[model samples]
Target chain A: MKEFSLIDTYFRDVSFQRKDVLLGIGDDCAITQIPAGQALATTTDTLVSGVHFLPDADPKAIAQKAIAVNLSDLAAMGAEPAWLSLSLSLPNVDENWLKAFSEGFKELTEYYSIQLIGGDTVQGPLAITITAQGFVAADQALKRSGAKPGDFVYVTGTLGDAGLGLDILQDHTDVDNAEHKAYLLNRLHYPSPRVFAGTSLRRVANACIDISDGLLADIKHILKASQCGACLQLDKLPLSSAMVDSVDQDSAFHYALSSGDDYELLFTVSEEQKSSVDRVLACSNVPATCIGQINGAVGKVDLKFNDESYAYSQTGFEHFNSGESSNKHRNNAKRA
Target chain B: MKEFSLIDTYFRDVSFQRKDVLLGIGDDCAITQIPAGQALATTTDTLVSGVHFLPDADPKAIAQKAIAVNLSDLAAMGAEPAWLSLSLSLPNVDENWLKAFSEGFKELTEYYSIQLIGGDTVQGPLAITITAQGFVAADQALKRSGAKPGDFVYVTGTLGDAGLGLDILQDHTDVDNAEHKAYLLNRLHYPSPRVFAGTSLRRVANACIDISDGLLADIKHILKASQCGACLQLDKLPLSSAMVDSVDQDSAFHYALSSGDDYELLFTVSEEQKSSVDRVLACSNVPATCIGQINGAVGKVDLKFNDESYAYSQTGFEHFNSGESSNKHRNNAKRA
Candidate 1:
């Protein structure tokens, strides 16, 4: 089939006219008319087969997570998603795969109210690249450099669940319990994007970041940007009940501190405004935990456990540093 | 070395402080404070090794073209580029490659006055994705649907040089010329982004699009959006001197009208604005040519050569439908 005919039959439904979108798909470029008082926040992410995802993973999950992770970036900026472009490279066009993928993509786009603007489709190993564009008011957007020394550090939702989910998926540990399996599977397959929680914190949080690279690593980004250090108390770290029940206390601590893929928000609030944050999150039914406090600008990260300070291993994920392709191995072992 | 340290060492130098950029690289997300009176335009493109480019192509040229192609999308919307985010996937952490890539990237960013923003780096097959953001006044951004019947169409620079350059590089064509080869190579390796021409067109052109997917296919997009049709004068199609000198005139026509990757702006302006466009291009040293005009809604693309309508066999490129991998027999025959 020709490219035009294929697009007309299958991908044409992806086009829709919107007042904000001056031009949708089927153009050399997509154009939008941003309102007078709004600013645009943009981000791009590429998920390569056998690199970022498993080669034979569920297309629905892949599509959802591809857009979800990028939305997480916009969430960190406290922006409202408006438009996106996709560049999908596949070995071949499989009808069933495209249907499932589009279904997954359309659902998330509708949930976020983001329009599919323009995109390019190509032939290659399965690779999906999504660029998400979001909007924010001129003075209302959040940033990573706004945290001060006296700010109270906060996190939305529990950490380490997604990482533990990966462990369960890989069968690294045998879980005979059905509910435990289901919880781990959900965490691995459909990690939540903290857009609502992030938007709510726009006026309250000093600085915000999405935790894709674990609590310690992601929080360090806020520290580096704000030119501050942090003291995270181990006892205050939040972990899922399934994670805590399945693993030993020390293992739970390690997972909570260093496990990645939990798409939650880590933010800092002023010490005086801590109660307001608690009240806001409680009303919204989103869990917000005060894990630590920003300290002096000494360029250090400290963790305290059981009234003792010990040097914890500071490893989350490092791409291309080691010979092993860790993500690929983890995914392949699941199939095995 | 870990991913964080590698990013710090290689990507640390891509820093700039602009008032409009509220935040930049090294943050969870880059935040921009768009000027009050402007609308934001955004786009993303992914170029994979051995797919969009020759696997052995220079890293400098790859970096340059990656930014240039995305900037071309902004220009199509009559937007001026302000920021870019790069998601790079490499097989290894090669210091020399990173230095070269950064240097090439920096040159283009500085030339365009674009700031580096937040992105991710991972280990995978060599692929580079960039999301570019630009700004224009709220009502001044161009769209594909603004062209009206009786409007004169125009294109900047010669077309098909990039496609012909690919032919020469692959040894499909035996042209024994040196300077001509250099020119074609430059066109393919690093096509200029027509920013100045696009900015100037904001005052005169009714609609505009950048030519990435050949004239016939791309012009169809404009026609579809504008609810109009076009009768392209094939005889008036512009061809580079080397193109005509190297191939027969009829073949040159095919290359110019059907070959893709020109990266020049194609636009429509009412007849009354011809003199203004001419004057602007003359003063700015930007080449502009008129080859066609809009017609009534006919729902088809037509071409005329010597007052006789003609049809060509080839359309623009469709990456998935191209049968590139399946054509291994043809490649083998050529090699033998």
Candidate 2:
């Protein structure tokens, strides 16, 4: 079948039964109903072959990661996922690849109750762009600008596993532990969007952001937006047992701080809200730890271990920072 | 500058003063307020280097066409354009290119009262995926399924100019009339989205579609969805004087029926509603001509040229039809 036919056959019927979706596929435009007094939230992410993922990566993994990363944006805003539009650029028609990709895309979207509303298929280098839309009540939506000077910083889930996973995939690092390799690889390929934790933090998190460009880089966005600084305790950084087993402590710390693609929530909460934030995270059954505090020195971020400041090898991932060799060093391992 | 910094420098301050957009750029997700009792209309389109346009094509024209095609979809649905998100993948960073592209993007969006709410830019091959959102009343959106057996079919503006433009670009056709070449090239690169005509025809048009994939192929979509057929009068198809002067009558008809990217609205109205439709079109100051009628015979489409039948050499553009040599033939003059 042709590209259009392949979409009709595999993707046209994968609607997730969203009540808010008035129209799905097969139209010039998809129709959606946003509830009154609510604001619709939207985000888009494009995953390109060789840049965002391996050109020979599994189709299922590619589709899942694409959807998950976009969903993570909605999660950072404390919004409820409702619908998505996909634009797929392909080098050629491959039915089996498309089937696996759609299945993986459907799997996460179904779990989030997001209907696949519309899509455009074209011939080109392989790239998948997904626009995910959700709803958040007015200013009740979380923003990076909401962080306060006295707020405590927190992150959901363990970090560095996905970064280590990329290292493993690129054959840059070797590990003898089979279980560690498997878990790290899963973290790299199928990092879960922290939706439950993000939504719950709407009442607690003063500001929120999803860690796609590493903790050091993403946290700086919150600081810049809120016009504040942060003091982080490096020893408090959370690392999965699998990541700890795969790499040394220093290597693990570097990955946790500078690696991208973790898809975890990094947020700040007021001193008064910290207890409630902890309570909510516990209730959501997501592991979270306080690792820093927002400070008065605007736009400054300091990382230390027990009051001893340590020089870092790199800051974080930035797509346009190719001039600085350190950024290349960061991308090499994180994007392996 | 970093990727996020580049976005902040180039894209953040373009709020467009949209009152409904409570939040735009800088956040994880943009926030929009949809009025009560209204449905949000969304469509996505992806344009790739080499496939959609030459890699060396003007960035301004590329940006304009990208937004225009998506707006054309909204126009087909009779929705009022509102918000849009852009996902841009670039092979490398070039400031002059980005500046020209943004200027072109801002030009059309400013006139249409649409807001650029959010975007994601990454390093990769050149491809742009834009998702446009609009608003329509509940159950009032125009659909291909609404056509009836007795509906009179009409098309807005001229057909086949863009196809001729592509022919001119590829050096496939040579004409002495420089004026005609200029006209055709403009039509190809900047075909106006029929926002005024489409919205006005909401009450009169039983069904509506934008001509992206030629009259014959696009009209078939209407027929397929409405479970009907159509009989088109080949002689009545609206063609510019330049088009008629540049090509023979048969060639003009072939491009009108088989080429793509006209971006005109092809709609059907009941016979009784034809006068009203005409009146609406007149008030909107857009030229439209009746050329056919819907029929009761399901899926049967017949074209007649002054009482004689004609066979088409091509259908429409399908991305992955290249395995068949005929697909390359279709792409030749249309995509050149």
Candidate 3:
């Protein structure tokens, strides 16, 4: 089939039926209404086939991850998901691939109640770029530059499972248990963006970010922006049971600390609002745990292990590093 | 350089300083404030290497054209350009190329007073996907499905210069005058999005669409959505003097009818609003020309030359076409 027809068959009519969308697909541009006294938050992320995921990975998984990561950006800003525009490039027209991708996109958009406003599909190498937009109150949008010295650093859900999942998928790690393997793989392939948790923290958390680039690397973004330091207690690091079962302590620690793609919310709350944040997360789907404390020492990330200080060689993923990712697939399949 | 640092060094500080942007780059998401009673009009377009332009095309031209096309979509919707997010995928780091691209992007953003909110940069095949957001009064946004049968069809600027420019660039056409060649080439490389013309038409136009995919192809989009037909006068097509001097009459007409990449606005105006639209256009930089009439006949595009019926073999560009566009580079390069 042709490109336009392919879009008509797969991408059209896939909206989640958002009421704020005045016009959807097939227009010059999509039209949406923003609520009064609210600010619009938008984020764009592009996931390349080889760089971001396995070339042979499932289309549905790719679609879900693509949307999730962009949505995670919104969540980081304490924005409620609203509308999205997807720009997809493929080598050729594959009906089955498109079908699976649409299903995955439809599922996530429905879950988030975000309508797919408009997009463009082209003939090229595989890549998915999604621009996800959301709304936050004028005064309630979370920012990274608001972390105070007295703030308690907290993270929602566990970290490193998705990064480990990548290792397992690439067969670089010896993960014996199938259940643990499946759980980690799911975490890697279908991460749930911390949407509700972010909205809940809007008025409670002083600063926020979603952990996509490992705990250390991403937290540094907060520190750099907020001009504060952090003391992370490694012992308090949250880990999924599957992560613990599938890897050794050192590997698990490495994954949780330096590996990436967790999609969990990492936020800071001042001493005054710590109780309020705790109350908010008590009813959230994923549990929240205090893992560190912000300090006056700017740009410092002091890692503590059983009251002793330590450091690691690597922080997180960097696209232009001379070294390759240890999680790269061993028998990497050729792109279809 | 790392991806984040690359973005900071090159893409950061490229803003038009629009007051609506609350927060821009360096955050998880860019925040912008939309005024009360305004609807957000958004459009996304991707220009791929060898697909949208020559593989070795100037980075500045690529950046400018990419931004311009997206802005044209907003203009078609009668939305004033407000903010933008650019997702750029590059094959590798080229500092010279990056500098030129930023200059091109910055130039246009400054011209339209559109702020660069935020975006993503990645290592992949060379492609630029820009999502442009604009605002229009809730009741004044133009749509493609509003034209009546009696509306007079009009188009802003000349129709075929940019289209023929591609042919000239590819050595498919020739002109004796360097000035003519340069003019046509400039149109292709730096086509202006009719932002002000569109805003003026918000109340005057019954339906509107941008002429990106040729006059016939894009105008048909309006007719199809509005459930009407059109009669286009071939003789009345506004061809640049350079275009006429550069190519044969038949080829120029064909380019005007079937070639793409002219970012002019095609809108329909009712009899009552025709005078107002003319008044608005009389003092404009680019002139608008009345070229056709909408009809009750559905999905029909009857062409006439000096009051005689005519037909063309092709409609417009289909991305998945078997034939390569002439604008494609001689030694077609592979995707990175």
Between the candidate structures 1 and 2, which one is better when assessed by TM-score? Answer: 2
Local distance difference test scores for all models? 0.77, 0.86, 0.86
- Measured against the native two-chain assembly using Cα atoms, what DockQ does each of the candidate structures obtain, in the order listed? 0.53, 0.83, 0.79
**Alpha-carbon runs more than 4 Å astray in model 1:** A1-19, A137-140, A324-336, B15-17, B322-336
Stretches of candidate 3 exceeding 4 Å from the true structure: A326-336, B324-336
Ten contiguous residues with the weakest lDDT in model 2 chain A: A327-336
- When just chain B is superposed on the true chain B, each candidate scores a TM-score of 0.93, 0.95, 0.95
lDDT of 2 by residue, B88-126 (tens): 898888989988888888888888989999989998888
The candidate scoring highest on DockQ is 2
TM-score of each: 0.91, 0.96, 0.96
lDDT of 2 at B329: 44
Worst 10 residues of 3 chain B by lDDT: B327-336
